[model samples]
Structure formats: structure tokens, C-alpha cells
Target chain A: MGPVELGDQQMVAIQTRNLSRTFDEVVAVDDLDLEVHTGEVYGFLGPNGAGKSTTINMLLGFVPPSDGSGTVLGHDIATESLALRRRTGVLPEDFGVYDRLTARKHVEFAIETKAADDDPEVLLERVGLADAIDRKAGGFSKGMAQRLALAMALAGDPDLLLLDEPSTGLDPNGAREMRSIIRQEVDRGATVFFSSHILGQVEAICDRVGVLREGRLVAEDTIEGLRSEFDSAARLIVTIDEPTDDIVTAVRSTAGVVDVRIEEADIVVSLERDDRKAPVINAIEDAGGTITDITSADPSLEDLFAALTTDGDGTDLGVSSRNRSPGRPRATEGDA
Target chain B: MTWLHVAKKDFHDAGRSRLLWVLTALLVLLVAGVAAIPYVLAAATNDPTPTFESGLTFLFSPIGFLIPIIGLAVGYRSIVGERESGSIRFLLGLPNSREDVLLGKVVGRTGVVTVPIVIGFAVGGVVIAALYQGFDGLDYLGLLLFTVVMGLVYVAIAVGISASVSTRGKALGLVITVYAVVDWFWTFIPMSLYWILERSFPGFEDLPAWYLLLERLSPGQALSAISLTLIDTFGAGDVDLTAAGRVAGDVPFYLETWFAWVIVLGWIVVPLAVGYLRFRSALLN
Candidate 1:
């Protein structure tokens, strides 16, 4: 069900074994193993300072691991970094721009470095930067800088695109545009590996997600798989025709229903098992509230991410870690 | 084996600096403005032949001071500045290797310094030809070649320090220390060591061969040695540069004037080689 099960040489885009890095004495990345298949967008999810950037740096040969080995596009990350980088496009974290150079010059530098015959204008236009192509990067906003970096990463039509925190300084709309550009790159058969601290940023684009906490990977699965693993507390929203206090009571009284609330036209019910959905719907209908629309909130990745990333706290299987404020999105700053 | 793109981009980035224009203007003044002084003095004395040798002799001291400063200013931050600003991501993120970046920076900053020198020579060379009677193009070209080579050596040294250090402060401090020791006080180092080891001050005659070699070791000294030969070719007999004049009866081959070219090549290659080795092994954190 995962990329590792493919067991083919050409199927792997990135692979690492026992990868570890330590800064002085603090282990930044610990004994990690990962396999990302060709042509899949693997989202590396972690909280801030959870060694996500360190892992990415090691993969790109920017940081040599204290131990272990890895390969990108079958080229050893340590020994053959130049050859690996030739086929790989990297949008590095905390990257700065040459203030004196224009947006077009930035992209042209990439193309020239990679020896790729690409029109910088085309790449800039692809990133919605046509109007600012000639502008110097010193005047660019953070989001504008992020877009320019993406255009540079898209140079040479790389086989693998390693983007670390690709949505750092984007507003909601710009984030969506970035997602579409990532989609276009993936559609062209390039593998994408992007890191994000916020699950909301990557939920709509990632093919598979790996949750990293405290320098160790905690969970790895498809989005659906991660949801199902934590689906015992999935929120169920039943859109009813009429606002009814009785419907909440009825659903709460139903077997396997844990919590119930009525908000406007919807009866929100929490279920213990996936099978309890039918009983809750029947209870709502029997309470004289007509069920027009029903949607199981599918644990929504936020809950799963919370459950996976919560530290030594009340991490009971059926309990919702959403109560822990640590899992909430802190990077809501829309780029000014 | 420098990447042309990196070099080109470096030149373009540095070319935009107002300091570069100021340095260019300064060089033009030093070359043309300063070289015309000989013509003024010769005209006042009603001397019939104001030789090119006088202009080269006049230029030797000022060029030594100006060339190293221009080279250091252009190259001291070539690598460390990118690292400090976090823009090295764009450089190493591409296909270029760390070695290529260092070499390209040397090549690039060499271009940055050479352009101004070329412009200054073009303007000043014309003025000197019009002012002086014995204007030999070959001797003038020889001096120009030495100026460019000296520029290249200083750039290599600055870039080497840029690559070796992790912080901008360290790079600046190291470059300053190198410039002061190599350019300003190199003669004093050998002199001090001679005074210490020989139990007496070294006189102008019969100095140890090691002392002469050590004295000519710094980039500035080697450059001067080569320029002395170039100036001698002017045949004006303005400055006596032959080693036998100061040394004992016979000079060792290593102290020969032409051996200074080997020292110049060493200054260019050694700093770059040392810088590349350090830069290649470093983790760009």
C-alpha cells in the first residue's frame, strides 16, 4: 500500500537509512528511514524546530549527516551531490535572494547553472510574476520572494523537486496558487517533497504524509489512511431542516455517540465507531429533524496531526488531541 | 575550472556598486592625473626627452597601494557575504559545486578589478604618450600585465579568506590582517627575524639568501620585483633593480628577477587552493 512495497529500483525517488544529525549534543534528526516513490508528492509534516529543515538539508547535501546515508535520483547525497542536484530542483528554507539582481536574472542564473535552455519569462509567468520580472529582488515582499524562488526551482525541468516549507510567506490565495503550480509540476511526472509545519497547508496537495516529532517520525501513511487510523472520534455533521434541541438529545442518547451539539441548521455528533453513523442519523430523523445533508468530518488531518504530534500528554487512542493547543495553526500570518 | 555563469553573475552583481565607480574614477586619476606630473616637471625644465620610464617610475608606488585595496574591496565578501545573507542557498541549490563557486568568485572579482585597471591604463596610457617623448608601448604593456596579475593575486587572497571564515566579521578582520602584514609590514618581518637570529642588524650588503627570498615572498614584494624588471626595460636608468647591486658578488637563481613570476603564480594559486579545500569541506549552516 506504500511506496516501499513497490520493490523496484526505478520506483524510488528518495531513500534514506538510519539518517541522523546532531548539533553539538542535541540530536536534530535521529535514526530516520524513508522512501518516497517516483512522481508522488510526499509531504514531510512537523512542528517548528522538529528537525524538518535539518532532514531536508541532509538530503540536499547542505548538511552532512552525523551518520547514515541517502540517495536522491539514485545519486548518493554525500558523494555525488552535484550529479544529484543536476536532476533535482531545491527550494531551500531560509533562502535569501541577491538584492541587486532582478527576478528574471534569478531564474536565468538557475537555468545557466543547470545548463537548461529555458525561458525565464515563461517560468516567471508561471509563478504569476510576469509584471515583476524586471524588478530587483530587494523590493520583493516575502511572498514575492517565495514565488521567485519557486520559479528558480522550476528551472531545467528537474526530475525531483525538493521544496522545504514552500508555503512560508503566502496568503491564502497565494498559497492556493502555489498548490496549483505544485500540481502542474507533479502532473508533468516530477516527484515533489515539500515540508510544512501546518497540516492545512499541505492537506490538499500531499499524496502521502509523514509526521515528524522531536527528531523522530511518528506516523507515515496516506491522508485517508491517517484519518481512518484516528477515525474513532471523527466528527459527524448532520445538516437538518429545522433547529431542534430534541435532535441533540436523541443523538446523544444513541449507542456509541459520545458528544452532540446543535449549531444553526446542523446537528454535530461525535461517534465512537464508524458504524455508529447510521444510528446517529436514525436518531436525528426520529427526533423529527429532517436530515438534508450529512458529512462525516473524516478526522480532517488536523485531528490526526494533533494526535500524532502531541507530546507526553493525555494521548488516549479514542481521545481528541485537538484540545491541546500545540496542534493549532500558528503560522496564520498572511504575507504583508 | 570556473563556471562562467557564476563569474558573470558575480561581475554583474558587483558592477552595480557605487564603490566600483568611485574606484574606477580614482584609478583613472591615479593613472592619467598622476602620470601627467612628469610631463609638467619636464616642460618646466625645458627638457627635450621626457621618457616613459619616468611615468612608470612615478606610478610604481601609487599603483602598489591602489591595486591591492581595489582587489580586496571587490573580493573580501564574495563568499562569506552570500553565506551571511543566506543567499548561498541559491548558489549551492543549483548544479554548481562549492569549488566552482570559489573559483568563479576569484575569476569574477578578478574581472571586477581588471576592468577599472584597463580603463585607467587606456586613459592614462594616452596621456603619458602625448606627454612623454620616449613612450615605448611594450614596456607600458608589461606594466599593465603586471598590474592585472597583481589584481588577480589579491582577489584570490581575499576570496580565500572569504571562503575560510564562517562570519562576515571574521572575513573582514582576516582580510585586513592579511593586507597589513603582506603589503605594509612584510619587510619588517624579515628584518625583525634577521635582527633576532644574526645577533646584529642586517646591512644592505651580503644579506642572507633566505632573507631576500623571505622579503620577496609577500604578493606586494613579488609584484614590485616583476615591475622593477619592466621599468628597467624602459632604459631610462631611473631605478637600479638588479639584485647584484644590493647583494654580494653573485645572486642565487631564486633571487633572480624572473623568479618573481613564480612567486606571483604561487600567490594566485595557493590562496585559491587553500580556500577551495576549506570551502568544499564546510557545511553551509
Candidate 2:
């Protein structure tokens, strides 16, 4: 295949075609195609055992591909791995840091190894690790350790950043800081590719997302595109001053109204299109029912992810379901 | 340049490990204790004449076994531990070649092992010089160099095993078995053959060259040769040259400096080459 160019106008920074990895009898990544653009935070969304880490490993040259190829930043992933590695920084999901070295030393070693000119102290401060920089990493808490790992990855000021669950062990405030840092890096014209099962975080940071299920890229699109595609139905929750049979009848009579359910005093009407809102409001007023409150709920990215990733049997989303309990809001296009 | 950075980092990191310091101290104590045996024996006997041969034999006797143990300790975890701890990926991610990584590790770890051995020998040599009254700096240097070379051989073998194996236990087991078979059991093969020659055939006084070559293959035999030379210098009892020693003697071997140099060079080069090859193909991830 000819070299795939990352265009100057286009944001595309990573492109893969038919990339596959097989270990003996099992295929880890199969016929996968992906594109992550420059200054874009692409979230690799997958459940546990969904080949997310395996794909990342291949991208980083930790493992070789069984078939096909790709390029990162115009460098061939297979043949020019060293050059790619030099320009790319990765924070692996599995935590592995030098136990004997302090956090500062680990970052310094990473920077030195990469021949980077940045000061490690500044990187440590940015990662919120300035206080713990002098302490050995063995005593670090899980979140602290992950922060240090992220610091190490960012040490070289790499052009491409690959973070696997970058906010895995962070608190709400820490997760917010991580999102801001990712945004700052992207603002500097770097591409950020990260994987996470946290739908909220992905929605907060990722410009686009790719969903993998059962070793395949089941879905890939911008978060906005996914929201538009999967949340084809919108719901309007309306609270009226008084319940009336005519209001229900009028809402049902409106064009583009799919379903309406009354819970307590609110009429939850599912719309076939976003334009149905004006017609539904006219219909309700025509029936002489005064509207007290009206709210439109768009489908989240998490909802789209759930609908797209579930097996036909209606079981197993294949990502980490632990810590993420049932009834948590699924990601939609409009989430922060 | 990247390799140098990695090597420097590895040296500093391993140096900071308390386990490394403890291991170095233990090795020094063991070597010093072993070297003091002859002195203690001579002092007990009230014989101020500490023969060079006895000193050589005493010092060289434990080397074959001790050197391999040192090798096992230093090398069995070099690659495997890094792999387990996830640091191997970081190392491999660098632009440096795998050979550099393996060689740097071997050099760094060898340094860790060799420093104590040298200090121990220096300390032992001083005690022997002060107490025994007859001191040959050249002989002591030769023996020290030989021991270090022997240490390198084990380091290489251990590193090769470490690169090939996934677990420390398996690498340790393989190293110990190889060391035992090569150092101890291989000698029995030549001895048993000689016994057969002496008893089964009368007037078979001429021994084959291959039998002598077989004995030299055992690092213990090579170390014993150096020990015998040291013993002779100290006026100690004679170290009998077995079939291998006789072949070494008949050849233009420099017992003092040249022979020691050859043995030491062989120990360092051969194992390192094998280790480098194995490590190059290792799937450290």
C-alpha cells in the first residue's frame, strides 16, 4: 500500500486499514479501520476483554500485526515503529512504574530516554504531582500512581498521546483536571487517542469515538454523529397544572408523536423528530391545558453506546460494568 | 545516545535498590571468609610459610560454585523482572536496539557483581600479605581477574536463560542445573574415562587430547588452574594437574598473566555473545 498522508488542512493524524492481530488461534483485533485526527480527542470505547488494549499495543509496536498495516503521523506503524514511538507518548492501562525511583526520577528518565528538552519539574506540576515528586512511587495511592504514569507519558511533549483509561482512578476534581490537560495538549496541535469505559468522561473530552465489541469496530463516528444517528427518537417531558383527557388525546393526535406516557403529573411524550415540539405545544394548548414546565431530553452517547454494543441476546456490553452500575445515564451527543 | 541514557538510568536505578547493596555486601563477606581460610589454617599450625600454591588452591576452590551462584543472582532477573514489572515495554519502546539493552544490562549487573569481588580480593590479599609475609601482586591480580571473568561467564549464561525463560524460578533452576552439570558433573565424565583407561587397558599411559579439552570446558577446571598457580607462588602444597591441567601445561600457556588473560577473555566473550543472540530474539512484552 502507498503511504497515507495526514493532510495539513485535515485533522487526521492516525489512519489504519484492515489492521488485525492474532495470537496462535485467537484473533485479538480483526479487520479494524480507524482514523483519529489532529487536535481531536478520540475515545476508543469498549468493554472489558474487547481488544482495546491489544489494539493499543499494536499501535505502539509492543506487538506486531498479523495482517494489514497503518500509519501514525505519516510514519508506517510496522516498519517505522521507533520513529512513531519517539513522536508518540502512551500511558498503558496496566500500571507499571519503577518502584524504587521517585515520581520525579521516573518522569526524568522518560524524558531523557525520549531525548526530550522539556523540564520534568514542570510536567510534574501540571500533573498535580509536585508534592509527591520526591517520594518513591511505591508508596503512591492508585490515583496518584496513575497521575504519575500520565506525567511520564507527557514528559516528552509528544505529538501524539495515547492514554488508556487516563482517568481510571481519579476523583471528580482530578478527572476534571485530566480533561483540561487533554484539551490543552490538543490546543497545542497534538492528537490525543484515549480509551475509557467511562461514558461521561468520554462525552466530556472526546471529539469522536470508536466503539469496539467482540474484537470488531462495531461503530465509529463523532459523538454528535452518533447522537443524531442513535437518538432518532427524542423525548419531551411536560408538566401541566392539571391532568386532562383532552390533552392526552390532542398530543396523541399530533403528527410525529410516537408514544406518550403519564407519570404522576408529567406527560412524557416521545417525538419522532425534533420539529414535533412546536406541533405538540400547539396541540396541548388547543386542548386548553396550561403547561407548567417543559423539558426536552436528547439521547446520550452512553445510550447510543449501549444500544449499539449489546449482543443480539441482550446481554453483555463487553466493557467494564463494575463501578458503573445500572441506571447511570448513557452518553448522548449533547452531554458535556 | 539513547542506549547510554538507558544504561545510565538502569545503573542508577539498580544502584539505588537496597537489595543490590545487601547482595554486594554478602558477596564480599563470603569471598573474604573463603580467602581467610588458608590464613586461619596457617595461623593454627604456627607455620608462617604460607605457600603460594595453598593460597591459590584455597582461593580458587570455591570459585566454580560461587561464581555461578553469583551469576544466577545477578542475571536471572535482569530481563524477566523487567518484563514482570512492565518496565521492559518502556525500555523496548526506546529507539535503541535490543542488543544495546541486553548488553547494557549485562554490563550494569556485571559491574554490580564484580565490584564486590574485586574489593573482597583486595582485602583478602592485604590480610594475606600482612600475615603470611610472602605477597605477589601479579598472582593476586591474575586470580582476581580470573574470578571476574568467571563471573562474567555466569552472568552471560544467566542472562541468556533469563531472556529465554518467562519466570525467575525457571531461570534460576535452569542456571543452577547448567552450572552444576558443567562445573561438577562434567569432570566426572573425564575421570571415569581415565579410570577405564587405567584399569581396562594396561600401559595406556598416553591420554587423549579430547579428554583434557573436556575438562577445560568446565569453568571450575580453568579456575583451579589459576588457583594452583597462586598456591605455588605462596609456597603452599602442590595443586595436582589433572588430565586437563597437564594438557594446559604442555601447551604454550602463560600461567602467570597470559593464561589468565585467555581464560578471562573466553569467559566474558562467549557467554555475552550467546546472551546477546538470545536477547535479540526475546519477546520481552
Query: Which candidate number would show the highest TM-score if scored against the true structure?
Result: 1
Question: Where does candidate 2 stray beyond 4 Å?
Answer: A1-12, A233-298, A313-336, B51-53, B189-205, B222-245, B248-285
| lDDT (Cα atoms) of all candidates against the true structure | 0.83, 0.72
Interface RMSD of 2: 2.1
Docking class of 1: medium
- Highest-DockQ candidate: 1
Measured on C-alpha atoms, candidate 2 has an lDDT of 0.72
lDDT of 1 by residue, A7-60 (tens): 455488889889999999999899889888899999998887778899999988
**Which portion of correct inter-chain contacts appears in model 2?**
0.45
List, residue by residue over A1-336, the lDDT tens digit for candidate 2: 322444466745788889988878788789999988877889998776677888887787777788888888778877877778788887877756777888888888788878888788899999999888799887888799888878878877888998988887899999999999999998987889998766778887788999886668888888888777645567777888886888998999899997776767777787778778989988888899889988766544565576455534222221212224433665433221
Q: Tell me the chain A TM-score of model 2.
A: 0.75
- Candidate 2's TM-score reads 0.79
lDDT of 1 by residue, B1-285 (tens): 327889999988888777678878998999999898878887899876567777777887788888998888888999999998889998998988898898789988999898889999999999999888788888888888888988998999999989998898999999999999898888998899998998788887677878888988888878878886665563346444555556765799888887998999899888888888888778875
